[model samples]
Target: MANSLVSIQILPKTKNGENVIPYVDEAINVIHQSGLTYQVNPLETTIEGELGQIFSIITEMNERMIEMGSSNVISQIKVLYQPSGITMAELTEKYR
Candidate 1:
């Protein structure tokens, strides 16, 4: 079961100062491929999974940016961990 929620905003330094939306899309793709529960927000994408898996996904996302020709990548990350268990639905249920 998922025990953590991680939100991240990845800012990849594009070559020649180009637009980064494509790169952001690439990062999101990585999250999608993980098959974990995820929500794409305007500023950041939130993912729900085990802490270790979430961390590995984050690493892959950053590496993907580098492979995509980004000179450098900056990631803003936030995490919420509950040893018992947690889910995005549980956290946002009231709002929904």
Candidate 2:
């Protein structure tokens, strides 16, 4: 079971005022490549994994934005950590 649920909304400032959708797509790609369970929502992407691993992924996403020519990046993050364990499905089961 995962120990953390992290939802991040990355806003990357482009070099030439380019559209941000592509940059956002790339960030989501990074998360997808991580092979962790994730859900991509309209405003944010939520990931399920060990806390450390999730943070590492977040860092990589930021680095990717810079590498892709983002002048700066702002990440809005929300975390729910439980040492015992937690999963997105478990948490949203009632809604489903």
Candidate 3:
């Protein structure tokens, strides 16, 4: 089983700054619709679920942001695998 988590930060340069919100909203909707749980913050969101679903949501979010005319919008996504819940040690094992 793949229990993964991801964090995304989107930065867009445009007059429609708020337009990015809908893209995130839609992503959350997809997660919710799929019966997964997630936490969202301004310009940042963390989702926990199967790896495929997590990536799928991020991809969809990117498409929506592009469709909304977000210029140079960049996404920073972090992925984690929770073997026994999340821990700093696991993070270090992956990155270090």
Cα error of candidate 2 at position 95, Å: 0.5
TM-score for each prediction?
0.98, 0.98, 0.63
What digit string (tens of lDDT, one per residue) describes model 3 on residues 1-96?
447777878665545456555655665675676666666777677776777877887777667666766655677888887756653334448777
Q: What ranges in model 2 sit over 4 Å off?
A: none
RMSD, each candidate, Å?
0.5, 0.5, 5.6
Q: Hey, what RMSD does candidate 3 come out at?
A: 5.6
Model 2 scores a TM of 0.98
* Model 1 vs. true fold: TM: 0.98
- The best candidate by lDDT is 2
Give the per-residue lDDT of model 1 (tens digit) for 12-40.
Answer: 99999999999999999999999999999
Query: lDDT for each of the candidates?
Result: 0.97, 0.98, 0.67
